[model samples]
Target: MRIYLPTTLALLAEQHAAGAVLVPDGAVVAEDDSEDAEYAALMTAADASAVQLAGAGRRVVVVADLAAEPAVGAAVPWREVVAVHADVEDRPAGADPDEDLAWFATQEVPDLF
Candidate 1:
C-alpha cells in the first residue's frame, strides 16, 4: 500500500515525527482564483494526476488543512483515498512528548489491500 501525503513542509515534518513512512516531500497547493491562481492550477493538475494514479491500486492520502477545504469524499472504483486533517496545534510546546508519541505508535493509518 502506497501512501501519498500532500501537505506543507511543517506538517510533513510532523508526519515524519509521527513515523509516517514514504511521505512525499511537497506542499499542498491551495485553491484561490485571485491571489493564488498558479497554485490553484497546480492543485488541479495534482488532483487529476492523483485520480489517475488511484486507479492503479495506489492508496492516496491527502493531508491538508481541514479548516481551509475539506477533501471530497467521492467513490473511486479501484482505489482507497483517505484524507487526514493536519492539526497545527495537536502538539503543544513544553508538554509530555512521550504521551503524544504513544498515540501515533498504536494508531492505524489504514490498509489499501
Candidate 2:
C-alpha cells in the first residue's frame, strides 16, 4: 500500500537522522488500491501538514510504498520513502492556503533542509 504521512520539519529532521519515521495515526491513504487514489490522499496529507506547522517551514508529505497494508502505527524506514512533496520555500506563518507543494525525489531529501 502507498501512504502519505504528514510531518513537521523538526520532527522530519529528527527522523531523517534516525533513519526512519513513525507513521502517524492521521496518515493518509487512498480509499482504494489505485494510482489515481493516491493523489487525493496526498492532498489530504498536505492539508493535514498545514495544521501541524509551527514557526516557519514547509509542509511535508512523505510518500512511501509498503509491502503490505500497514496497521496505521509503525515506522517507515528512510529507504522506503520514494518521494516527498513540500512547500517550495519557507513560507511566512499563515501563508497562502492554496500554495502547491513541490515534488522531490528521495535522494534530494537531505538538500531540502
Estimate TM-scores for all models: 0.25, 0.85
What TM-score does prediction 2 earn? 0.85
Worst 10 residues of 1 by lDDT: 97-106
**lDDT tens string, model 1, 17-102?**
55542324333444443545634534443443334343332212343222232233321222222343222233333333222111
Q: List lDDT for all candidates, in order.
A: 0.33, 0.84
Candidate 2 local lDDT, 42-84, one digit each (tens): 8889878888886567899998888865666688999999898
As a whole number from 0 to 100, the lDDT of residue 103 in candidate 2 is 93
How many clashes show up per model?
0, 0
Q: Pick the candidate with the highest TM-score.
A: 2
